[model samples]
Target: MTETRKTVWGVLSTANIAVNQVIPALQKSERLVVGAIASRDEDRATAVARRLGIARAYGDYDALLDDPEIDIVYNPLPNHLHVPWTLRALEAGKHVLCEKPLALSAAEATTLIETSKRTGKNVREAFMIRDHPQWLRARELVQGGALGEVRAIHVSFCYDNRDPANVRNQLDIGGGALFDIGCYAVAVGRFIFACEPERVVAEVDRDPDFGTDRLTSAIMVFPGGRRLVFTCATQLVRSQDVQIIGTTGRVSIAVPFNQSPDREARLLMDDGTVLKGGDPAVETFGPVDQYLLQAEAFSELCVSGSVDPYGLQDAVRNMSVIDALWSSEETRGWADVRQD
Candidate 1:
């Protein structure tokens, strides 16, 4: 019997997402092992390591990267820091899973792609929602004719955050609704439609005090003339959902963006069922920890050297849409997404 070697992972920050979602997931994955965690303060790193049962703790990010034993690193740093850390990890001959909005714009994402190629290591932007079975099921339903010729996608993700100091509400560290939640909106639309948007239009409102964008709404026209509209906000009632409206029927997901582990998720499609005597076709998925599944999937890629679905190229596409949206905001009109 061949002994399976686990992919050893180090974490680059004590960010809440890393601690709450990712670390727990890594701890639970069969193919991955938690090697260490890093913080600027040695005591803080040591405390987090002890609390999370990580084997080692380093006082600085480079210490873990400098370690020859770690195979990969999970970087849940500030949005602006994501690309730099991932580049460093790749240069060290380690794979990277960096939290999304992989980079500030398409240009940086392209740089990441080049860095990955030069370093001979891979970096996958961590968009955990893409790994969720719910999304997979949605893609299946959309492409399988459950919804005939999807014409429009609507995604809404928002949360009310009045805190001035939170990174999402700050201007310097790349804080805003578009970067915070719109990434998911754009990603899910692209994944379901399997196409790129040709043009984009966007509206954004800035916070008076912080100069951070409080709300962002955008529309993208995709190949085959399909369309996606998504709105995200930093100060709004919490809501998350996605709908794929088609020519024949429409599929709707109840909890689309933020996959809460406490509740069951459902996908429903009505195909002239209400007018007729038939009930709507429905499927419900039991609770799943998407981050855990993401860890397992990424670990599998690291171990097998298989290509990641959301590698730097995919990240670049997503960022390009974001860039187009920002451009539209400036022009208050349509902006073209660069065709390849």
Candidate 2:
């Protein structure tokens, strides 16, 4: 028997995520290998490449894209740079797996959808949560009638970050609580409900100095009256939780967005029989790295041309809800999500 050839992946930058999480995960996957890394500074790129055991380091992004051995590009660039760089990677004949909140808005994301079709290369937003077993079980319980008709989901995610130079504090470059952390709240709602929200309303609190949203809360109305209410903040105690409510039961995720890769993940399901659901059943999943799963899955997609159906199109849908949320803040009223 012969071993199958693993896909080669070029990382776009030495951004924190690429260095601290995604690069390590990609190196761990049997289906993928880190072929190269790039940065505006060649020395920085070379240092990261050497530290991560990558073979090549490019002084510029296009150099990595020009590498014929590179079959895929993992882009963890800033929010504003997602679309342009992803488009460049696609044109360079490499599949792309970009970071979450794939674009600043729905219309910007659609360009990737069109470019993917035109270039015949795949592009996927890196929503790694969808690949986690715990989240998978959560979706199964909801769809399998365990949750009885899931009615609503509530999410709260926040952290403390006041650095003036941090990308999350820059407004013109798409920095805010909504773009940085709130996107998970929006994406998970669509992931669980398996449909787009019809409309949304939101309230935002901007930092007086940074001019970026320090806190944001929103409500999304899905079909059949299902809804998602969420609040995300960047200047508060670090915390995250999710609860899925239904007619008969509910599921609570203590750490929904940033589950530690080394520890087991557990979810609580309650039938409302126990007082305050004190004795809810616990479903546990052994340790797993979702980023690794994401890399392997995309590698499979690249090798076989299997469509994820929920690739770039789903990204546009997620961005639509986000777009509506921003619009709601301005109008101080509900804004219909743009479906087209």
Candidate 3:
């Protein structure tokens, strides 16, 4: 007998992330089918559906969620909308894979977690960096004691988002350097250290015109006294790097964070040995394919009645750190993460 296909998926927005990544990924995944595409504008939704060859297009997000054929909902909406739509999808009995910074605040993320439990649905935050092979290998090295007692970590993810009208510069929509790029730094820090930070201290620079943060630098101290110094900027040139320093040696990965699953990445050790990895020729179909992998993982969990590595609970903890960092900036001191 032939095995049945795994899932029927929907796109929650016509955002670039979906247009470029998710749609193509769904087309590529053998286990999934693109059921529909949704946008606030009818024409845009129709156009995207045609371009992606999706069966249906809905002008309203709720319509897509209400569709019985859509088993998975890929939400790439603005940051502030993540929580609401995710909760709506869960309540509608659709598995949700939402983009990063899962929700604008920790409270919102907590609500998502609780709702998922009560509703018995799967909800995950799209942190593709963790899903890539290189990142997985790095984590294994750190966790396996190959690095021998990690001492400090330094990470940076900065890029120029010069579009004044772009949502990344909008505060009300939950746009800022911290929400956009700083999230990756925080994720890498947590993964390298294998735990949440015990304390967070940060400083943020607000754009005079946009009124949103243009830059943020934060220092997180982890349980084993490991320090992670990181920075993110929306007004600077593109750069991504991560370094893990230990007592015996150290490891560094160039372009350590991003959507590129197949880019050339290097691991440098203290002994002057450089282990090369990642494929420079492998082009990223964009964040969507990563989202598909994420979707597949979530579906496996749903099928086996297991929990994902990065579930709604993990999203809440990550957001708690984000909230604490912002609060630390306001208080001008280190702030402890408040868990629910």
Best by lDDT: 2
Error of 2 at 62 (Å): 0.8
Query: What is the per-residue lDDT of model 2 for residues 301-327, given as tens digits with 9 covering 90 to 100?
Result: 778878876689888988989999999
Clashing pairs in 3: 21-288, 22-288
The alpha-carbon deviation from the true structure for residue 327 of candidate 2, after best TM-score superposition, in angstroms, is: 0.6
Model 1, C-alpha of 13: deviation from truth (Å)? 0.6
Each prediction's whole-model lDDT (CA):
0.87, 0.91, 0.80
Tens digits of per-residue lDDT for model 3 on 209-245?
A: 8888888999998887889999899998998878887
Which residues of candidate 1, in runs, are more than 4 Å off?
Answer: 1-3, 272-279
Determine which window of 10 residues in candidate 1 has minimal summed lDDT. 1-10
True lDDT of residue 81, candidate 1: 95
TM-score of each: 0.95, 0.97, 0.91
Candidate 2 TM-score, true structure as reference: 0.97
